[model samples]
Target: MKLMVHYTLKNKGLLFFNFICVFGFIIIELGLPTLLSQMIDVGVVNNDDAYIKKIGLTMLAVVIVGVLMNISLRYFMTRITTNVAASIRQDLFEKIQDYSHNEYEQLGVSSLITRVTNDAYQVMLFMQNFLRTGFMTPMMFIASLVMVLRTSGSLASYVLMVLPFLLIGVVAIAGFSNPLSRKQQGNLDRINNILRENLSGLRVIRAFVNEDFEEERFDKVNKAYEKSSKNLFRLMSSAQPGFFFLFNIVMAYIIWQGSIQIDQGTLEVGNLIAFIEYIFHALFSFMMFSTIFMMYPRAAVSANRIKEAMDTEPIIKSKENGVTQTETSGYLAFDEVTFAYPGHAESPVIRDADFSAKPGQTVAFIGSTGSGKSTLIQLIPRLYDVSEGEILVDGVDVRDYDIDALRAKIGYIPQSAVLFSGTIKENLRYGKDDATDEELEEALDIAQASDFVAELPDGLDTYISEGGANFSGGQKQRLAIARAVVRRPSIYIFDDSFSALDFATDAKVRERINEETTDATVLIVAQRVSTIMDADEIIVLNEGNIVGKGTHEELLETSSVYYDIASSQLTKEELGK
Candidate 1:
């Protein structure tokens, strides 16, 4: 709830005006009844036409003022509520940007999406209702109750008698609805998770022929969500009829007593009319206020979820005034580094790994699956910190350098190529924001993508769909390499980036990279033996341990682990056996 208050208070002036309108609106609503009673009691009864007309005109003016105030209140409330929701979502996104991979895995991705979209929307709806009715209803109820007591203390007793029942009903609804709201939100997250998987992996699901199975899985969750929703609606629906029943009973009793008094000449017809109006306003206001109370439990649940995401402290953050500059660039080393995931520290993934590289040298890592080939390169950019030892870039510890500065020194391409929705030129600019057209073409040439790109109708202006779905796997990978190449960073990390290309194209791309990046450090993680055969050094990993290290020729003779991998991928002639 504090999340709502924080953003809402930013527009204090609008809130003030909203409150003023509500106050004026309430005054007009209560005053109109009083004016009607006067017109009937004095003007009509005494046969004074002018007095009746004057009171009628005053009532008309009051009603007009009420309408204007109502409109202003709604306008201000909408502006404030929309801004608050938007700000919360924007801040949540920026906060997520600062989170490391560990945080991302800790909070499931689909769950985070739900909090950003659905939960924020819940807050928005609650704010709109609260700003409109939350403030106005209580004041109106109290004022109308005062007028009720002044009109006829005897008849007001019936209205007061029904108040306890309504209060208990409101409290009961809030208590029951809260747990249901939480369950509903949790179910929504599951639905989103399944939907994301289905859309992203639609081809795989079809290939596996599991459409029926997937439909059954979706139906099961959907039914559970529907059951919860129906139960919640049932409870709310029943409460409304029960409230009106109590409301009618009170109205009937009040009118019955007022009529008997009027027949006995103890109460005038005008006072009875005024008393009925006051009673209606008072009880109706309480009902409106109760609706706000009912909304509070669900809104509070959403507010807490948003707060949890916003309050998640990113495990990795830049040091205040951390080292940003070094005397050199592209000097990389790992000093006896040992690493494990957050919960699997006892089983280290990369144990006692020590290595170094300088400019003009290419280091390649190859191993069987789950050998931490990709993870090893990720450490250079601090996607996950080293658990035991230090990683140095340009002789400065990675932890000591500002996070952004550390990453700026390296061009990293992950195991998968991900492209956003934009033109070819826009995607390349991600690596170097202000890179020139000539620089882009040069990078495309080096990545072996210039020919395909030139054949396109729009060339650099061709739009790439989300995730580059329109392009082949090989094309996306090459474009990814070009994006990195455009940066011209001091160090380049390619994590299994060439697996999509054929052997011939792979050779050409590597040949181009070798000749071009002579002055920059290059590290490649590959499973293909031919990919790393010409490297300056090759480190082989098995079960997270570096079992062999040497060049291709040297490893074939001395390191049996490297010999076995090379033999499996290369024929007798290629292995020189």
Candidate 2:
């Protein structure tokens, strides 16, 4: 949090200049009342019109300079605040992109989103207020207090009596507001979580006709946010009245003393007038400080939220002297590897799992849900580190190789067929940044996506809606496959990427991929037995353990799981047809 402040202030030099101008403007404002008092005492009371006009012009000049200074300060302050907010948001976004899965899980997506959007905005507002008022108020208050004391020590006693109580009031407010502010941010994160879940699962909700249920759930979160916000603002609202009440009591003391001095012929009318002006300046300045302090707790909570994300360091890192395998022969091996998620201490996801695929050989993993099929595939690209053993590529531990070099060799198509909102060509080119039109078409033809693509008016340039909502499920899946094929990676891992496609299209796509890249290793995780029936080797997973390993014929006789899965699917020729 301190570092964020340092970085924000360091980049905003104009804000500092604006701070100085504001400080000078406040000092000049304090003199206006004193000058008015002088005009009344020296010119008007003494019947000197020239002197009145002279002091009046001086007052006008001061007012004009003060207004101009204020306008200049406001301009710079707004610019500084806006730029700082943008830079902070940009840095935060970049950090999130680089964050590892472990880091993301630790800070839930809902909280991360809230911190990036709402919390960042809160910090910006606080900084704007801090620059505009934080510095000037305290200095002006203290300076006015000094003037009041110098004018009359007796009158100074009245302010001293009330100030201690005001300080105590502010301290009490800070203590209460701090915890409430933190709670408010937590509530906001919960609201974000609720909304994110609903948005992502909107299709399922409509399919099930559960809109009312989802709305009820959203209402609960919204009500919580409202309650938390009310509590925070309730505390803040009391600050103004509390200070005003105490200052009013001090004003009564001034009136009482002024009546006595008038009877004693000691205090002049102008002196009392100046004293009243000083009291307004001093009290209001303190009040401004109090208001700023009231907002500090909320902004501080936001800062802490943002700092938590920025401070995280990814678990997976590249070795300093790691070598890049520019021309990987596509040999992948897992040597006695063990891994588990952070909270699951029962057993490893891949418990001493061992396997190897030589260049050009096809390896398949057949598993039920939660059988660690995806986790096992993630290890090849160093998405996660092995807990107890090493995962090797080309006989070297993947962790010992440069992260960029290792990932570049493997093309991964996740279970979900995610597509960005852009042209079909743009999404396909992500795998190979320099992919030409010919390369895109070649890959699309292999993935069985070229037929539909060619039918579109723009062909490869047809726009894809968010998450490929414009296309069918199978179409999105094939495009994702095409995206992977365009990379021309030495190793391809399709993690249940073909589940949506029909058996005929799936078989044709796989055949094309095998034919086009004979030297590339293919690793697949699939639920359908037919998908991996003809692979060189298949490992069957159950309860995170590889219960069976054999060819399709060997598995049918030896493994119950394999036999049952095979019985559910059609024969190879039927599936191919």
- Using lDDT as the measure, the top candidate is 1
Alpha-carbon shift of residue 350 in model 1 (angstroms): 1.1
**lDDT for position 89 in model 1:** 94
Candidate 2 TM-score versus the reference: 0.94
Q: For each candidate, what TM-score against the reference?
A: 0.98, 0.94
lDDT string for model 1 (398-444, tens) is: 99989999999999987689998999999999999999999999999
Q: Which 10 consecutive residues of model 2 have the lowest summed lDDT?
A: 568-577
- Supply the TM-score for candidate 1: 0.98
lDDT for 180 in candidate 2 is: 93
Number of backbone-clashing residue pairs for each candidate, in the order shown: 0, 0
* Candidate 2 residue pairs that clash: none
Write down the lDDT of every candidate, Cα atoms only.
0.91, 0.86
- For candidate 1, what's the RMSD? 1.1
Error of 2 at 403 (Å): 1.8
